[model samples]
Target: MTEEPVPVTRAVDFGTAKLLPDVDRARAWLLTVDDAPQSYVDLDDPEHLEFEYTRRIAHVLESAFDTPVHAVHLGGGALTLPRRLALTRPGSRQWVVEADRGLAALVAEHLPLSDPDITVHTTDARAWLAAAPDASADVIVADVFHGSRVPAHLTSVEFLREAVRVLRPGGVYVANIADGAPFAFLGSQLGTVRAGFGQSADLCLLAEPGVLRGRRFGNAVLAAARRPLPLDALARSCAGDAFPARVVTGTALAALTRAPVHDATATASPVPPDGAFTVG
Candidate 1:
């Protein structure tokens, strides 16, 4: 038998980045920054989403529209979701903003993206969003993270406004937020997103039942749009996942309360408990 490929490790801008191969899936790689799991991509199968949060994001988009879309990704970790979108929605145009140039280059060298429609930029996500043309993207995905926590500036009302500004009418804004019981950060983020969308939008939170019920620390996906969301279809799609998730809306959603975060007061999300997102 041939020797297994060793993990590729590099010192990226933010931290040490590693691409560990999946023994079961030859072309699959798991990316980690400072020991925190960041992204997993199966080169041979772009449709395969190893992370639950990614699947939830896909559920929101798939349930919302069946046609090609103009998508902006705030975080580009291995370009996993972008690759999936390219396959699922052919002819789709995508822009990915990743802050770490070294990490982006590492991904490019190891896991090159073949789609001519997708472009990758090395810059701050919030800054890129501010400069993006009005109504340019049909979907904006906010999955940026600094190590295991979300950066403060990207969690503010101003950033949310920029995200909304970059989206086309009725477009969706989806973010992968992590929080546990007494979800102060999560609550504040939901409030900030709602405030950004104003009174005309439909907002929903998706997460595993345990996570919602305060049983554990995990990722929660926030999806908001100006138009009515396909809640019924989204609910069905989420419930059918390998790790079934629940969608929160209406009064249950309203019960989660926190002040909208402004740039001055914004803080990075709370640090995860040990091994909360670590992958061996």
Candidate 2:
């Protein structure tokens, strides 16, 4: 099968990326930044997730709550997850905090969100979370990144605390972190989340088997909540997914959380080496 050409391309503040349509699917579009896959959108089927990490996050959101919820997204790359949320749970109020105005505008003009409940704001994710009222949202998602690396401020304990503070009782906080083998960055982020949520909070880590085993560089979905997460349901969801993944909680999560906690002085997430994700 031939790959679909990107009909539209632009140079944004950070780098250059393009929206490439799926040759087989008329409504599907894949966004890539500097040739690295960033986000995928299926306008016709928001429930159909093309990326493994995104599928994990969607599963968490589905298992986290049964009713429509108020969600705040820290990053807005293509707004794929947000669009899925709006479709799966109608009437849900969603807010997106994105720092790239040009990119946001590009997505708005090209793949405009049909959900009136979804609002986009161009600002720093940390600043927005800090200014948000306490216990104001049922879920908070952190997926902010600069190029391939997550910004230092977003990975700090202070940022996690702010995210937890904005979540209502029994609310969930989920973040998508990318790292390489040994997963030192992932471990530190887990520690930071654990510290912010405390021992009583339910924490779970989901990723591909290879990624979890430190054999590859990939994205991991870290989820935490003030109350117990529906692990049974989450596990079932992961199993049923098209791209099968694994969930680690309880003892395994504790082991991973042994890394040192990161504060405000922490630097950005470690960058993967050159060609880590490049196409052959």
Q: How many residue pairs clash (N, CA or C atoms closer than 3 angstroms) in each of the candidate models, in the order given?
A: 0, 0
What TM-score, over all chains together, does every model reach? 0.98, 0.94
Per-residue alpha-carbon lDDT of candidate 1 for residues 57-136, written as tens digits (9 for 90 to 100): 99998889899999999999999999999988889999999999999999999998889999999999998988889999
Give the lowest summed-lDDT range of ten residues in model 2: 256-265
- The lDDT per prediction is 0.93, 0.85
Model 2, span 60-151: residue lDDT tens: 99888888999999989999988888878888999999998878988998887877899999999999988999999999989887778888
The alpha-carbon root-mean-square deviation between model 2 and the true structure, to one decimal in Å, is 2.4
Best by lDDT: 1
Which window of 10 residues has the lowest lDDT sum in candidate 1? 250-259
> Pairs clashing in candidate 1?
none
lDDT of model number 2: 0.85
